[model samples]
Target: METASMSLLHALKEVLSEQQVTENQTVRELHGRDESYHKESLPDLVVFPETAQQVSEIVKLANKYEVPIVPFGLGSSLEGHVIPYEHGITIDFSLMNKILEVRESDFLVRVQPGVTRTQLNKELKKYGLFFSVDPGADATLGGMAATNASGTTSVKYGVMRDQVRDLEVVLADGSIIHTGNLAAKSSSGYHLNGLFVGSEGTLGCFTELTLNVYGIPEHVMAARASFPSLNDAVEAVVSILQAGVPIARVELVDEPSMKQVNLFSETSYKERPTLFLEFHGNEAGLKQDVEFTREIVEDHHCLDIEFETDNAARNRLWEARHNLAYAFIHGHPGKKMMVTDVCLPISELSGAISHAREAVDLLGLPGGIVGHVGDGNYHTLLMIDMSNQDEIEKAEKFNEQIVLYALERGGTCTGEHGVGVGKQKYQQKEHGQALHVMENIKLALDPDNLFNPNKILKTKDRG
Candidate 1:
């Protein structure tokens, strides 16, 4: 470590308990990389702070010494959002995991940055409420908000940004601020909560968050529908949304992914393009919606559709869909998983997914296409052999082709995954002059470029 780096390290040690500070190689390695295949850069030291004040103190010390600091949760980010590329200190929030408050009547929950969605849901079960934004990873709430994550449930309950009601943030100059209030609706100030939630730690570190929750639905139903082709599956979802089916969740799984799901999950689900559908409401209302959804799918030439009202059966259905990524990882022992996320308009989703399948085939890569088609967002999961540079290049080229296709048709390069180095290049093309405004915000909030350096905007003086 350099003199300044070592000095900052010593300062951090003095500020916190000795057990909270460590330069252990094993711990640093664990903090080095997230779930992404992006190259790892280990941190010089790791620190555990159990309170927002401690996080504030750490931020002050980092700014004082001109050292970079990155906030880490469970390291579940897929685009390298948690990786400490600048080799500074990592503030792992695992130790701070706690449910701060559950305002049951208000349908809101206040939690520390470390609480995971499943963990919160388990607690909310007692109150007959649930936190709804599940990104399929049991990811930390702070990590989810940083990436503005969404999943199958997002088609109904909405994404992380929509759930966040307030944020207790520690800024670059050690000043703590709240971006929003406890009210359900407000036009009082600038949408700071909106700006900070998806800023990917470039703005500041979120210590505590107040979020919206929902009461458990009176009736819940899930189904799986198999289609002959990918376009048919996507078109069915679009039609379902168009016909006002009020779907709680609608996910598309291509035939190739369905095969992987069967192989890994040990279930004989039809190895064809499939749609996972769900409805949440009172029993009578759900019955009407289910019938309407069935008619819509049959109109689009669905091969076979089955519905499950049993809770265990519904759980099994989603568990397989959520495990698709791990299925690929388990099947390919030595390879890495790169999932390309792109979202387009509902009118263009069918074409976009078809183009994605052709690109994967044209590149001769082993990949699967799946998505939350209810919201016009989809992903191409590419399994790459890391040792083979040629395969890696092909996978990257496949991503570029799909991204360009989405951009050309009024879609985003990434739907849920934030611009964590992987999607930074397209920020200019996507945002154009608006990119300059983001850079200005970065420079104004963190002029030293120390907060999660080289993420999102790739700001001034970051070279």
Candidate 2:
């Protein structure tokens, strides 16, 4: 019998058009990994499917061969979800990218999985609508759904899961299925939409998505507020959320992260713990919200507050925050960005973050803490020399300690970044009995475990 890789490659070439397949090392290397903590291992092949039919065929072939099929997007995932650990096929969705339909009346847009968030937003702007799941990078919609990603705007607009109204998925056995209808809020069948949204490609591959879009607010404003201490800045976010200011974005930048932003973005942001905020509404409502937020921030001992009412200034403010991860990468010439994501309850956020900061400081690690504070989610992006075993161990320990703290506080090991291979160890600890149910679901959907094998749910050892 032919090897899994050879057989799957042959089947893919036979079914797909000439443009849909490649075994080029350069291209395979590019799709082999994501922006992650894990090391790279190239996939045996790369298949670019342009339509749902094509995707279904590719998955069917892989399933038949009992080979792992890792779905590739923009390669922006912080976890190793896209990495083909079992080394079979990397399905690249870039060719399938297209805006299928835009329903202005219904506030929804149907798009192929490969379309990036920025790409979708650019087209939507003509209709006065925008996709709200901005993960800083222009990540593909399919990757966003796979990771159930949330970002700066998530506190108000909800995560990728919440934005998706429907999904066209290609299951492990190469059967195509629609997860949801256009109608919002359905008590319909088993909530398949929710299951696939964050499934991380373990059960099926998303070929297309009908996502919820938002209208451009009549008024929008951004502000940057500084505090003497990081905890004070964190406290202000808690206060703002509790007061219900309807903040669109509330991001916390530590002094170190602020320094990196200032240096990389060529902006003179004060090197202090700061909260960058955005408010959206009608003119009168936005003004009221800003005023209310100011009062709350001042009460928390805010050192200074600056608001950006103009488009250019507001864009600059958000650009600095969004470009933070890149800033770290740019600042450290040869270092990799190893970030930890742990989310806790609002009440415990400050404690969790404080402990994380102490962990970094105590270990003398070069890292910075920034957070989606309104939602009690934070990340510590550590710039480390990958060659140094000591530094790598420190990064791993920091992640372990922070995750344990969050788990103890009714929080998860990862807030937005899904449990790819990197976070699998924490799954049982976080979910316990729920994990058993997840395993059962995994078995039901892809008993062969060929879809994104060794990710999210690892069953190789059990088998």
Candidate 3:
């Protein structure tokens, strides 16, 4: 007997407008990939639902038909989270791009899933407010929340979870629920909002998000400090943080990364391991921070200090830092960028970075290290030919080794990036019995494992 889900294409054609559903091979193929280094999996169908009500109804149909539903946004995920490997429905949120409310007085903004960070920032500029969780991509706010993403600004502003005030979720059973309240602080029941924010769409579908916003800083300055050695730069960052310099954005890019940026971004920065830093505050406060930061960097045997005080120069400096990922991508066309992230305590950062550099050298991979050093979180972007089996094996071992290094030093397997499929194998080792507790909660919230199944938790095969 044919399952109800087997007839979903026909049912969807009957209920949804033509523009809302499509089984076109091109569309399905487009929806089936993310920015991961993994192989792609095309969904059997792609659906675009425009509202929370529509999402709930579609999920209800999916539940009744026992069809898997994968939520998709900008497809900017570095992990394989957005791929519908089970070949069911992929719900695209492009049509849901609506900014529902801009509560400037409350310093909060409510927006639908499809609104991208750049789009929302452009809109927020008029109000003298901005959202802070930037993952270098103009990714959708829902996607950012799903991954708990962070970028250069995360050192001071925190990640996606820190900004999320509430989430409007569509459960696996087609029930609609709100995960949190509008208040700034809450001692409420279960912290469902926190749970769902980093759930990577495995727990429920996020249709709308209320996020905290910040008033634009009055003054901003960017600086680049190059060290003779990577350890000197690492120690400088530790001292800056320990001394409470109030540095807004402190990023570390190693010598090879700097060289890549020079070639890709067309700017001649020193071809040595460097720290790109930013300070934000009142002019007086910023000046004080700059002086203090310079003293610390110099004390750590700093080689040079270049500060950009003009707004245009400051913007350009950050643009270079933000474009580092793009630089790698542009420099290595046809090769996939296999990026890995691990965060260590400040005390262990220098050692970990040294270990990472050694591994990269031994593996003979064309990769570079850059990170939000203030938080001791870093990423290594490897340019690899996916078809090369030996290269692929080296990448996997390198990732495992780095993760093991971090875990042994009381750090996490992943810092900002959630445990999408790529890091799921390490879940047990990282979380231990806490992993079971997470699985139990998953069972309670999504008993059938219908919502983003095989993501954060494993389950029996529906087949």
Candidate 4:
């Protein structure tokens, strides 16, 4: 086995620079896991491919050797999407990180998959534009697109799929193809861009992407609204959305999560259910929206509402929210974090969240609840000691209960966190006959199941 592994490594080095290919134990360990609680497994080898042609060649080698190929970005995914559990070759795209072209007038930027959300935004800022799909982890664009990630601003702008206009993909057979064109909308062929966005690397490796960008809004206002209860916070979001305030972002961080934030961030945030809110529009329009939003929150029995007046202050507000997971991890020493998110219709969100809170309390888990709740999606963060089987079982039960509850109410098992291994069992229940069509599509695109095998569409080996 060691000799065969060396043979594969030598073959990979032949295709690229020797420095770009490594089988070092440390590098393999880093590529094995993602930001989830799933068991991590190291790939036998790791390859850094700097071009679409390089990616194509690597995929061809994987197919020739029947070794699984898993595409990796920044390893920020929360649902174990990038883990090379089957242990083959992991393609790391960090060297391919570059901003290729910025078509400012066209509101499109073409970039390599290795470019990150924050990095792309930094570059786009010079052009008076910004990429709106922020999954909050500084995740790579390819990984974000793989998971179809959306974040706080999704309520107004849209998800990752909405931002991606076209994709340059290398398929299972090493054929490079562009899934879509630069045109705004096309009826010319199958909507491959959308189909591939959430496929979770089960289809092909994305090499380059043409994405839609938006001009920075004229006026931006951010606030934190503390509510008396979790239900109150969620209800206020539904009311705000229904009222059409053109809210750019509204997040729900429950009471416990607020405590975690205060502890980890060294801020005396109110130890109660809170909603982080942001509005983008004209100055006069934002003023009116802020006034109206204040009224709505007050109607929902908001305790206190405070607005961040400057860019630094606003960034601090969202930064604290984005770091909520890290806050929980910091608070729970030497414990793994289990996060589950569900999406319900706005009407069903309050009840769903209430149920989640109850389940967490009932299970006696130390955790927090924070979410991109403006779009009826929320995440529950639970800290579990890996050695404690009882705690793991209870956490699994908690996850199952919430997923079943949401599914019964026309909610999905996940909203932003893609269906990696953790959520595969729920796919059939969630999609029913539609799941079969997805299977057919997967088989059609990746016949040998060599591309990120056993991820979204589970194979019998893992199941």
For lDDT, the strongest prediction is: 4
TM-score of 3: 0.98
Q: For each candidate in turn, give its C-alpha RMSD to the true structure in angstroms.
A: 1.1, 1.5, 1.4, 1.4
Query: What residue runs in model 1 are displaced by over 4 Å at the alpha carbon?
Result: none
**Which 10 consecutive residues of model 3 have the lowest summed lDDT?**
1-10
Instruction: For each of the candidates, give the backbone clash count.
Output: 0, 0, 0, 0
The C-alpha TM-scores of every prediction are: 0.98, 0.97, 0.98, 0.98
Question: Considering only N, C-alpha and C atoms within 3 Å, which residue pairs clash in candidate 3?
Answer: none
Task: Rate residue 49 of model 4 by lDDT.
Answer: 91
**What's model 4's overall lDDT?**
0.92
Model 4 agreement with the true structure over 345-451: per-residue lDDT tens digits: 88999999998998889888898888888888999999999999999999998999999999999999999999999998899999999999998998889888888
Q: Give lDDT for model 3.
A: 0.89
374-437: candidate 2 lDDT, tens digit per residue: 8899999998899999999888988899999999989999999889987899999999999999
Misplaced by over 4 Å in model 4 are 460-463
Candidate 3 local lDDT, 348-389, one digit each (tens)? 999999999999999998999999989989999999988899
